[model samples]
Target: MSPHAELVSRLRAAWLSGKTRPMEYRLAQLEALGRFLDEKKQDILEATAADMRKPPFEVEVSELSICRSELNHTLNNLGAWMKDKHVEKNWATQLDSAFIRKDPYGVVLIIGPWNYPINLLLVPLIGAIAAGNCVVMKPSEITRNVERLVAETLPRYLDEDCFAVVTAGVEETTRLLENKFDYIFFTGSPSVGRIVMTAAAKHLTPVTLELGGKNPCYVSDSCNVQNVARRVAWGRFFNAGQTCVAPDYVLCSVEMQEKLLPALREAITEFYSPNPRESPDFGRIVGDRQFQRVQALLHSGHTAIGGQTDAGERYIAPTVLVEVQQDDPVMQEEIFGPILPILTVASVDDAIAFINARERPLVLYVFSSRKEVVKRVLERTSSGGFCANDTIMHMTIPSLPFGGIGQSGLGRYHGRSSFETFSHQRSALLRGAGRETLNTPRYPPYAPHRLPLLRAATETKRRATCLLL
Candidate 1:
């Protein structure tokens, strides 16, 4: 057998042996994952910096800290999440114990994205562990340094028999997807999400796709321009704007656009100084291909502020474009870089119409002081998540489920949602053998009187005592 097949077989064997089912084993694995994060803090920071020139502070906050929080949250709530939950039932089922059993899908496959490699990979792994399933993690090959770090170092902290990390590019990933798995969790582009879902269809496997889209930020005139610009600029330029939920473009009135331009220039200068390329907090493009793609977009609209590029260092300045049209190339796809385009709309209604006309975004931001204006936008459009005045802050809360709608992506995973995504809620009903008389109505005995009695008993009503007779 091939190495990949053998690895899957080994994990399947371990799962079949019931080693991963016990609460003790699950807790130990979660604790070990925590230890892995804590022990490899420096290594993770260095690796991410090597792979993408990501600043150490950004790596610590966005990558390491998020994973640690997820691990800690899972540890604290694993028992409560795993416990069999009793569900209310009808009168007929009241005599029986009806509860939902959170059963783990035997083995899971997790495919991580390159942007935030460690967090994307390990966070899902935490959920699979909490759900008591064996896992095979495929870290993105594009982020070579961090991929090597995880493939080499993570297994030592986890049970080799129950968890494995496979490092490869497209060819290997295609082959890996051919194999059967109980569940698959993938975070990447929508085009690739389609491929993952197609492959899983062969085995009838379930999948959760955390894909990307053109997230829209609508700025109303009823808000503070400087505050709005600061929030939007930070969200748009964080990680050099490689974020999936980053505001892809801004939609506002021409008046608001005029006000926002100066404020944005001020915010950019305050955040990254006059020469942003020299700022240590700023990051470069991940590779030459990404650099070239983003470089082509700088020519889309008239550059309002900060349009600088360096091919050798893979640097693109935190840029903002004004007078952009709806059909421009930059407006076409998810601009996974530090390029923010502003398209002018006549009014808030026009902005909502423009947003509703395009593909549903992973996130929608509406900046306004008026509650009614925010309420109007929220009630009209559909998105994976929404933030009234801020950007990318909705995802920080663990209680809110994070996922996409329609083409943006499918399924969600973040706190209890993550555990539930990896689990199958098996409906369980237990009753005494002496309850044979109560079950007679469900048995096939040709009796007209029984039909009326059964229908009346099961129908929606306050009193069911008469039907029982």
Candidate 2:
């Protein structure tokens, strides 16, 4: 057998042996993952910096800290999340005990993206572990340093029989997806998401796709321009704007655009200084291909602010483009770099229409002080998540589910949502053998008189009390 097949067989054997199903075992794995994060903080920081010139502080906050939080949260709540959830039943099922048993889908495959490699990969691994499933993690090969670190060090902290990291590029990933898995969790582009879903369909396997979109930021005239500029700049330029949920473009009135431009310029200067390319806090494009793609976009609209580039360093300055047309190349796809485009609209209704005309975004942001204006936008549009007067903060709350709608992506994971995503809620009904009389109504051999009596007994009322068996 091939190495990948053999590896999957080994994990399946471990899962079948029931080693990963125990609560104690799950807790141990989660704790080990937490320790892995804590022990390898410096290594992770250095690797990310090597991969993308990612700032050490940014790596710590966005990558290591987030993974640690997910691990800790899973550890604290694994038992409760794993417990059988009892569900209410009607009079028909009152005689039987009905509950949802959280069952792990034997073995899982997690394919992570290059951006935020560690966090995106490990966070879902935490869920798969908490759900008591064996995992095969495929870290993106584009981030070679981080991928190598994970492939070498991560297995030492995990049970080799239950978890393994496979490092490969496109060819290997395509082959790896050919194998059968109980579940697949992938985070990347929508085009690749379709490929993963298609491959999973062959095995009738389930999948969770955390894909990307051109997230829209709508700035209404009723809000604070300075605050809006600061928040928008932070969200748009964080990780050099490689985040999947980063605001792809801004939609606002011409008046608001005029006010926002100067405020945004000031915010950019305050955040990254006059020369952002030289700022240590700022990150570079991940590779030459990405650099070239973003370089081509700088010509889309008139550059209002920073528009510097260095091919050797893969540096694209934190740039803002104004007077952008809707059909421009920059507006066409998810600008996965440090480029922010602002498109002018006439009014709030026009902004909503402009957003609605495009694909559904992963996130929609509205900067407005008026609750009614925010409410109007929220009511009209659909997105994976929404933030009023802010950006990217909605995803920070673990209690809220994080996933896209329609074209953006499918499924959600974070906190309980993560655990639930990796779990199959098996509906169970248990009853005593002596309850034969109660089940008589459901059996065949129907009589006319019995039909009326059964209907009356099982029929639901507008205002009804629970009936005793």
Which candidate gets the maximum lDDT versus the true structure? 1
List model 1 lDDT by residue over 314-418, tens digit each: 999999998888788999889999999999998989999999999999999999999999999999999999998999887677778899999899999988999
User: Which regions of candidate 2 deviate over 4 angstroms?
Assistant: 457-459, 464-469
Error of 2 at 300 (Å): 0.8
lDDT of 2 by residue, 149-173 (tens): 9999999999999999998789888
* Model 2, global lDDT: 0.91
Clashing pairs in 2: none
Specify the poorest-scoring 10-residue window by lDDT in model 2.
452-461
Task: Write out the backbone clash pairs for model 1.
Answer: none
lDDT for each of the candidates? Answer: 0.92, 0.91
